[model samples]
Target: MAPPQPKAAAKAPAAPKSRVKKAKLGKARNYDLGNGIVRFSKTKMFHKTAKYKFVGKKNPKAPKTKKATIAVKPIGGEKNGGTRTVLLRRRKSFYPTQDKIKTHRHHKCFRKHERNIRPNLTVGTVCILLAGRHAGKRVVLVGVLPSGLLLVTGPFAFNSCPLRRIPQRYVIGTSTKIDLSDFKLPAHLNDAYFKKNKKSAKRSVKRKEGEDIFATKKEKYVPSEQRKTDQKLVDEAVIKAVGKREDKKVLRGYLKAAFGLRSSQFPHRLRF
Candidate 1:
């Protein structure tokens, strides 16, 4: 403490770093070899081989293009002492003229007209109708009509739906199927058979001399006898087929029940 500390030695300054000069990169150059030929060098001093020579001749002159000129005629002759150029008007056509003739070839259709039925849908399969007058009603699939429409029935006893045609796109195929292999469909059960007969013009009944038109009774509409017989025949066959199965009661109840979705029911998650 008593001895005064010697002055600290001054710190020596750091030596400066040596600056290095970067080498300049060389550029390629072209060397003329006479007779319209030239060779390119790989670098400023490195020349390529003779095989790398290219022709350096001037390009040939392009041919002159023809200019379109408009046809003009002098009007009023020379009597007026002045010439007025009038351009010839071209004949205008409503339809465009085609330079090339095209043959009338029939258009080829690439679309498929016939629809593929779902693997789950088959004859005698119980399906839920999704659209049309009988939507939500479960009906039995009879057979596919020639027009690609599905023929179905409610046996006319359970849901009151008679033999009718429905498009396959409007039905949801279920897992339930009835055995109708042994059952034969009547020959008249087809698309044409379902067509309604055109009704004749109704003739006005000769009203009594003072009869009131408002008091006249109207005729109630009734199904044709042929239709009733057809429905009975189809329903009998279906009921007979149902009777053959052990779960006939359950199947009948299922067909009679209407299809519906609950709050938690998701159609996509449903198997059928």
Candidate 2:
């Protein structure tokens, strides 16, 4: 019998594809507006890489010693006697990726800095801290920062309420207030604003003082500026006081009093 035809040679396996490594991505923080709209904080990203190499100077092909239509002397750092030549090339230009073109994005809005904010909570509003060392403690709302952080103060005479920024979600608003109406709010207030406040007198009507109503010269240096160290000490003390409390029973009691809730009350944090 005729020998069986040798089986067709097995086709060589196709070469495996080289996988391109995915670029590392940076995490972006998200914020929620009162409405359904959500805001993504500015992303930390490197600018796009240059697209094309920089254009080089055009020079005559022929050497200057040979003499040509163009100047024989090199315009740039080319051959010293003949046509000009480029020494160090310039940086390449930036080019965008195909993916970037598919999805166009605006980086930052002009209105990002201009806030038309009218927050419901104000300075001196009684708040229940729901997070951090000051969590479950009573704190007087300090002021709404431009960045929308609730700058709060525990005044930590007893509670460990570090003067810190609690996310809006962790702050529980209550009907209590510390009568800060007499206090003047500042433009773009921060934790330091509280320090200046402590050093100055409240904005109460000035009474007759020795019947001498003379123009008080405004000192170039205010005494309040010097109390930064003291303010920092207070902040540290408040944070320490809150962190040291393990039982937190007193803290819970304070929370209950601020919210006016009973043992059976299943009160949840108020969200706006």
Candidate 3:
């Protein structure tokens, strides 16, 4: 078997073409240089040169309307030692249409007429316990609930009493008064040496140079003159080239120069 030198292995056959037809060629690709950068992709750029077309001849000079003339009223001085002395008059509203007028008299609830009937429950009003185990015990009506329930602040036995337990003694009276005029803080709690423990906190985020906090986020109306000729193409290229790899420094440079992002600004992750 060694006598015959090993013959060179036969080369593999090339792939055969399928019967499926190829796609037809479309329009030729258009290209342009944009924003001082070489852009290989194509894009249509346009600009507005004129306003609306006039239907009639242009009028350069036109007559102006005359200004209105009116007399000024004289001021009146006060007579009763800087006191106001003017007759007040109530005016009726004039309705232009008959449909707006109503036939029925409307009753109004005047807020000024509403009186504070809540009894003088100032820090002590002797009230009787109406319900519960201590139904007869007298309690001080410390406060009154909007729902007509009285807050009777008294002994621990009556403190646990519900609104139903509030009796005639718990009834709001002016007799029971707690003198708070000479009340003072206890000696043990009056320590000026007490101080709060300090802990290091995170620094607040600082905004970029040209940012306004209260400014409404408006749709950026890019003028035709200010817009880059091939911005879309450039952005598409950048996105495609920078796919997957997220180098913070490189991204910072590109974003700062191209999109006006500040380097010291906080980093935000880009979503796909």
Candidate 4:
């Protein structure tokens, strides 16, 4: 080996510096990393050594003051060396829970008290007609008019009476007791019933006349002559009606007795 190469100098290893130590600042619920790194607890916030500084004391020379109260002045205050006067300021009140304001509508213009109308005259009142063409009649008041006229209906026959003829005094609108027995229904004549009853009465009279006509007594002489003449005419009629019927035994007997005809006799045919 060539003169044992000058023994190579032994290489010296580089010295290792200390790893960054995790730091603990005061009781800030946080940790610090060496070389100016700060870690906030439970948050990912980080700060450099220069940016993250300790909180310092507040300034001590600042002035202090208390809150001021609001001031109210009178509206009509006098100026210096001038006359003073009084002024009133009124504000309308608003009540949300108060009852509603009352308003009236459709009040009657007709004064009941002024007119002396009985207080008892209410709606659906019944009244009677006192003076008119149909006096002593009854009616019902439908309403009171604005002109103080009473609107009434029926005395039945006197339904068309004017309002002027009706007196307020006689018109008893409110009565707890009304005797109805004296009141009669309106008179109405039925021509059909009258005609039927008259016809029946006439027929009864005719029947009695017919009986009398049939029942009159006959005079002895005149009646006998009449009987003979009537019997002859009746015989002719009977002979004409019967013809030549010897087969009817009862008819033959009647003819024999009525006419003086024998059973075997040849009778002449007589025209009536």
On lDDT, the leading prediction is 1
Question: Would you list the clashing residue pairs of candidate 4?
Answer: none
- For model 4, state the Cα shift of residue 85 in Å: 61
| lDDT, each prediction | 0.80, 0.56, 0.40, 0.42
User: Model 4 reaches what TM-score against the true structure?
Assistant: 0.20
lDDT of 1 by residue, 64-169 (tens): 9965445545467568645554435555567666677788734444343566777788999999999988889999998887777898999779998888898888
lDDT of 2 by residue, 1-272 (tens): 99999899999999999999999986434546758455643332111222233336565687548433343345555555556544354545876565444656655575466543335576667687777755666776756776557877666454545456767888767665445554443443464454343444433344466754553433354535434554455445433444455744654356334334557766654341
Candidate 3 residues lying further than 4 Å off, grouped into runs, are: 1-120, 131-133, 157-174, 180-272
What is the lDDT, from 0 to 100, of the residue 122 in candidate 4?
40
TM-score of every candidate: 0.53, 0.35, 0.20, 0.20
* lDDT, candidate 3, 129-216, per-residue tens: 5456655454444343333344443333223332222323334243434333232222322112122225323333456678765544
* lDDT for predicted candidate 1 compared with the true structure: 0.80
Q: All predictions: root-mean-square deviation over Cα?
A: 36.1, 27.6, 42.9, 47.8
Error of 2 at 56 (Å): 48
